[model samples]
Target: PGPFAVNTATFVGYNLGGFLGAAMATLGVVLPSFLIILIIARFVYNFLEYRTIRAGFEGVKAVVVGLIFAVVLNLLEKNIFGGTLAFKNADFVALGIMLFVLVLKLVFKKKLSAIAIIVISGILGLIFYGMFPL
Candidate 1:
């Protein structure tokens, strides 16, 4: 529960109580973690010189990468593959859009802004799902 929790709370609060609800929900979710991280940051640099602390941080870095990979796989399974890896069940249009964005990233590299990619993807989505429905 980090950014996702904060975002979820914000949206739910907005639905329930407008701007004030969103503000409260975001603060409620973030304040505790913010304080804890603030406290940790103050002492963490001092402890960084110790080998055990450095090694623990390194392990944490690896675990975070693994967790991100797992989440990506889960999203691909549910969205592009329609809950399975079988080709027959795959959503080819969604896969096409993903590949298109990847190709744009590869070709454009740093030239393309995230907003441009988002706009392009949104147009593709509208064309495929809304206008054509195929």
Candidate 2:
């Protein structure tokens, strides 16, 4: 009526503390970033009304841009070209083409929304893979 399952009590209870450990692990990883964002956003909101603060924001924006560029470059190096190399299939090439088009779209400030892009890609994938008959 409700549910059915096989028993794995030994496996499950053997790591009962694992769930609490995950919470501690997540807080450790995220606490610094959260505190930094809170401090930065608070400072910006507090000071943005002044002319000097506005001038300082422009410098902050340039630093933010450099940080964003470095992050993007690191992501590209790790995901697209690094890690494990596999060129036997066309998935990676397709991903590269999709990424290039998306970057161009963003740079030009094109009027396409993320949902539209995702839906179109999903439909293309379904067409190529064939829908399940049910």
- Best prediction by lDDT: 1
TM-score of each: 0.44, 0.38
Candidate 1 residues 49-117, lDDT tens each? 999999999999899869966997887688666755433434765566575777477547767664677
Model 2 weakest 10-residue run by lDDT: 1-10
lDDT tens digits by residue: candidate 2, 1-134 = 11111123323433664666555545555577779988999887778889998998789889987997799688767766787654345775575567557655764586666467667656755654456311
Top candidate on TM-score is 1
- State in Å the error of residue 55, model 2: 2.2
Per-candidate RMSD, Å? 6.9, 10.3
What is the alpha-carbon lDDT for the whole of candidate 1? Answer: 0.78
